[model samples]
Target chain A: MGNSVSEVQTADDVLLELRNLRTWYPTGGGVLGGGREWVKAVDDVSFTIKRGETLGLVGESGCGKTTLGRSILRLEQPQSGQVIFEGEDVLKMPAGRLKQVRRNMQAIFQDPHGSLDPRMKVRDLIAEGLVVQGEMRRDERDARVAELIDVVGLRREHLDRYSHEFSGGQRQRIGIARALALRPKFVLADEPVSALDLSVQSQVLNLLKDLQSEFGLTYLFIAHDLSVVEYISDRVGVMYLGRIVELASAEALYDDPRMPYTQALLSAIPGNERASGRARIILQGDVPSPINPPSGCPFRTRCWLAQDVCSELVPPLREVKPDHFAACHFADAI
Target chain B: MADGGATGGAMLLEVQDLHTHFHTRAGVVKAVDGISFDVPAGGSLGIVGESGSGKTVTSLSIMRLIEPPGFVASGRILFRGRDMVGLSEREIRGIRGNQICLVFQDPMTALNPVYTVGTQVAEALLAHQDLDRKAVRERVVELFRLVGIPAPERRFDEYPHKLSGGMRQRVTIAMALANEPQLLILDEPTTALDVTIQAQILDLVRELRHRVNTAVLLITHDIGVVTELCEQVVVMYGGRIMERGSVAQVTADPKHPYTQGLLASMPTRAVRGQRLAAIGGAVPNPLRMPAGCPFRPRCGQAMNVCVTDPGLRNPGDGRSVACWLY
Candidate 1:
């Protein structure tokens, strides 16, 4: 089975691809003749996730990481762009076809407590996805639920318990179990471990890693914490405002960050051991409003090396090193 | 005074064997079980833990802010050599904001909605000091400037909602420091703010601690904040103190498995590619806490002796840990 999985992995690689993706919501009031203002939640994000590889999407709050993940899954329709999943453009797919696409792509939300239904028992919650897809009978669903409970390291007795009855870590496990119910080829874990405690976060992260290997799954892990991203990701994309500034292999990005924003973020994370680099690149000012982001480079407002060229021309995501892409004029200097 | 001796800098607050419990409908939740720590004059201490770790309860107990059904069941709260536990409600009120002030997590809720930010700051000052209207206004503007609030005069008339989240937090800090209290308790002050704003607030706290010579009791979950500002750190879990030591000693050489797991789980510059080493199992319910060690169920190196509830014992050093492994 493992050999077959490895063979399938090589053949059916590149599970999900997004190009020029933009998601914007119209704010209610505007000064210009009642014309609505658009909050550019996600603008021109492009990335791909290959089968069995974890692509971490990292940024601060309101940097559009969550929006990008949602748009890729079509949970929130993109304003414009291409989301090609399994060689099919998901945006162009009809509602009927989109339903089938959902079976392949699932999402685990940030708040486990809020995501799960309060009234439903743990068993029903885990099996709801299967029931919705009409893929199994009641007896089979119950058996699958029991199996999933064990898989997620939850007790079988917890099946009857409500969401509130469990702790934060347990609730997150239930969330993971539910996402895995459909045997999704790709999972969008949007800050899955952010709300859990530090100790519990590690446990959930290990579980996700194990599940990915077992299912040969691809993941788009979105989070704000750089350390977590560095730990779990095979490759990483650093987002600022509404655009990705750096994308590289996890080790490469952490070892040699090209973008100033990425450098600041990396510096912000405390070192595990006493011995580490102490020179922090403290970015000036807060992230500008995405509604009216700074012209050219989105990060130029907070960047230390902002010059006329940076404000005049937006740097493209060009490869500075082998397979490492950075969108900054001074990428070479970094 | 310069050598960090016991003279002059007396103990500002000494909490001995404190126990705070919540009488919920389900059962009596022992939120803060027999925990003891202290905040000396001009010293900053950080209490770090995940949700339901009783870190917040410990602070609330000291402030005498726990509402009905939740009360401090045991322990002595000694503030400036006075027993705070037996103080009357009015007497506690006098000491609450005048000598000891608390800054809450959510700045939006901490400040009243209807009142202007300046008015709130004025009210705090008015509670302790007797000043005329003009003098109060002058003090409020001065505080706004002191906390780095831009356009102090214009901001003085603006309501809480009018200010930005960071600015509102500054207003809260200004209010907390209005009376120049000897001790300031900040409960996750920057947890809800942005990272940049969090950095600013942390810097502000550090600066204020130096300027006022006020001891700080900072309760937060973020370990980075602890390392940045705190001199000493107390690691709590399931309503008990898991470990307590100087930040350097605790972060560098964590004695408790829980503390090590926390440090490990935190994504830092080191741990690369490997999945974060998360401690398995959830924090045990405070209502039905496991006998012996409260953290034994979720502990990575749990042994038979761990089941015999270990108390905080000095391991031949100044550091204290409540783990059998130690």
Candidate 2:
């Protein structure tokens, strides 16, 4: 579970691999409509999550980080892609097989208040997955639920209480417990600590890290907070409007970012002492609409280094440095 | 005593011994209990805290926007040497958007979606000023440009929904600056924007403050933002100020236990894989607050003397800390 970069890993080390994923939503019309625009929420995204390592995906809202996570989990059906999990294509799996595969993959949503069912008791909330899987009896489920509650730093008494009765942090703990109830190998935590208070935020982050080590689980940590992502991620990926702009080990990406978009993002962090004395790059406008994203390169509109070639041809994500991939035309030149 | 009021010459906003409370059926909740601070002319002060810290209540109290069941119980809100606590509704309305303006986090809620953003900003200007329609249009366009909205003329007639979140925030800022208010109160202004958009907005705010020379009262939970914008800061917790000092002094060398705890808990301050020194336990339940120091229950340095309130005491360096350890 140590956060070391395995330079020479066997093929067995790979747990989840996404190949050319495309999740598009038609806007303003039905399928029969003549003038329908597709919002490419996750446009041909490809990445992998190794065993027992956290892959942090950083992006602005509507930058397709959430959509990408959802698409990988098959929560949002992709238009086309291969969600290969342990040598099996989940996208091609039948409903029954998909249901079985889902037990190994779980999701923790952003809002604790909205994610947890307020009407259900904590015990049932955590046990619902186990109950659905039906691998354990009632007594076993009860014991597992009890054990999960304790593991997540919640007391046995909290099992009887409803979600509304608990604090935001506690509710998030309940959500975490629920996500971990089935002992999933890969967990997609989307902004898990975003809604929490500063003091409470650290507690949840620590819990997530501890759980990862204890259970030997891999994680796809998706969040907008750069600092939080850097703290937890072994490798980090920067996503711009529906595409992975840059991906590298956390140290490499932060120290010497290849893509202009990645550099701009790092500079945008408020009071980043680590990158002190670095010039701040405040992008002029909001992200372009995903429905009609800038052609060739999604980030070309806001990129400071944009040129004619940037708009004329798409920049393929290539290894510009050792283990560091970037999709900018000037990645090598810069 | 509100020492800050005496230090900063020509204090534009002085909140002294402010106690804003909510009189619900259960009991009274002291949302802002005896918080004192000052914002000098053209100076910026950040009120930093997490949720339930009374920072928002203090801003609302200043704006007189706290509704029924919640009222400013007692406090001297001296705005430009005028006591605003007992001002009549009609009297305060004259000063509300004219002399002081408020820009909150969500611009969508602040703006009227039915009307065009231009009309909303023009309306804000017309409410406090006597201007012709042509002049209003010109001023609105100018304000929009000043807030960094591109194609100001084209965007003038667009509805709030048409603008992006950052553009909507710029519109809100344009409205806030319509009357050239002396004091601007922003509550978590960039909390809802993307990091890059947030950077843009922060730059806009800094530039506007320099150009307009308006005193600012910024309420936010992010320490990085406060350190970047504000000269002075007041850290709040459980409806009271835990520490007050220059941003450099407080942030670099935090005095109070709560202040230290808050600064220590920030993920930005830690390296990768390093465990953060988090403050244990949740914020106190407002309905059932612990006696004396509200933070004592979770304080690592709790002492017997903490049973009694350690009111704001200056240890040294002109920084006031509300902890017995000082």
Candidate 3:
């Protein structure tokens, strides 16, 4: 967690910091009503992932979890805000310097099938990252590839195999191996296990956890599945319509959710343990369109406890309890 | 036709010792290997499994939808005392979408891009029933309304591509329920949809179940979806039923290691900062399935007994398990 740059002073403490992050896609075209209409994919979101800790980003699909992950890695440029990595603003860094920064910050995608190039062998795919960075010699790169292959529980023989030859779980392992090739300090695992089987998902998840401990890695684990997020995350952030509604320790968010949206999301999870005597707070409608999102509280349209005031004014995320920040007008009441 | 006449309390659809295999260039891949289960009248049975687990193949085999290179090799599918195996294509078609309807995953593919949602649903209704054009149109609007599609009349004119993912799925469900079929087969109907849309569709299914008393053979990988809708649960792996019982019995007191592992691996109801308990190894290649229990290679509690093929056997309390451990 040592700071590589002076600008990133709190080097040993925080691995990544996002301030007022906003990612917008332009919509509409030409003529009389021609104006740059933004989709507001990730709107005014802020969070910090500390060194060696996994920050779980939980939200429904299209709520900007993927967009946020990509933005943090600078895979997609943000319209505004700063992505401070190791105290250095990644958004402000030049291309050559950004390329250097990427060696320390890597990403694992949702679909293993789509992420990996089918034509490349597993060994070549893993070595691509190391080769691009030009950090190690060819022989060293090959050794690093083999070591990563073993670390992610893939056989040495699998190096010659293509992505199609392996199963979903095996392919995901290859993806992880490629990500860890450079020995990154921070990784953005975006729905890494979502496409995998329930039984196989656990294996990949456990593997990630073990690897994190071994390498002293920090993660911004983004996923829609709350249970998986809860299991892997030290701190949890619940997002809705491109804004974080609640941010707290995993236990606190699950045990005592202050936001109605958080409570509803938790209640939606089935099974006897959670379902027993717990009156599910079924939200009324679908998430509001990001194109023309709600004025104040984004979740007001679906929030059960939403009132006139909730619609009238947006609630600021304030720390109501120790390490628990909630964005709700009636956070205290909840 | 072993059982010529239907008994009063006979199961609505009884699939016994079913085997579906695909003849690939390499070899014959056993997709559904001697799997057996029953869906009672108006009861909901969930077939839970991951990809290549044979859950989808089981439902397709029942519907006689096996494509070229894939065929039902062995076993009987008794539907209302009739042996569906070796039935003529015409005879099967008479029963298909009439007595039993199938709502497949990806509504976009299941529906016709050329025609309106109403026309497709009307075709399903007209296929079995003797109805005039006006009567069919009336029924189409009614079906759309029943499935909770807003503004039925306006939506009926719109093509499949024009409708949203949720609306297109609603049209599929509407088509499935057009004839008020006794049995409905839904193969991961909501898997492609978002979570919020999934919740809506599940609610719609529950409502329809009560309204039509239609027995459902739901095939899905989501345990959460099964828990929310099903009464009986069948856990599948390597084209076989690893475990089957009442949802409460199977989920709460799982016996088979595969079933136990699946339950443990689910991310739902997990504490923060805990590592998910994942089952080791990948799903065995179907072309090269192990000689003994197909799950043995990945089974966390694999024993010497697992070397021998473990047939699905009754494990008391009306539960069935295909593991030597039980």
DockQ of 2: 0.74
Candidate ranking under lDDT, highest first, comes to: 2, 3, 1
lDDT of 2 at B254: 94
* Model 1 chain A worst lDDT run, 10 consecutive residues: A1-10
Error of 1 at B141 (Å): 3.1
Off by over 4 Å in 2: A1-10, A273-275, B1-8
The reply for model 1, stretches above 4 Å from the true place, is: A1-12, A29-34, A137-139, A270-275, B1-9, B300-307, B324-326
Between prediction 1 and prediction 2, the one with superior lDDT is: 2
Which residue pairs in model 3 clash with each other? A8-A87, A202-B278, A203-B278, A227-B267
TM-score of chain B of each: 0.97, 0.97, 0.96
Chain A vs. true chain A, TM-score per candidate?
0.93, 0.95, 0.95
Calculate DockQ per candidate and list them: 0.55, 0.74, 0.58
**Mind giving the per-residue lDDT tens digits that candidate 2 earns over B123-228?**
9999999999999999999999999999999999999998889999999999999999999999999999999889899889988887888788999999989876
| Residue ranges of candidate 3 with Cα displaced over 4 Å | A1-12, A31-33, A272-276, B1-8, B268-275, B300-305
Worst 10 residues of 3 chain B by lDDT: B1-10
RMSD, candidate 1, Å:
4.0
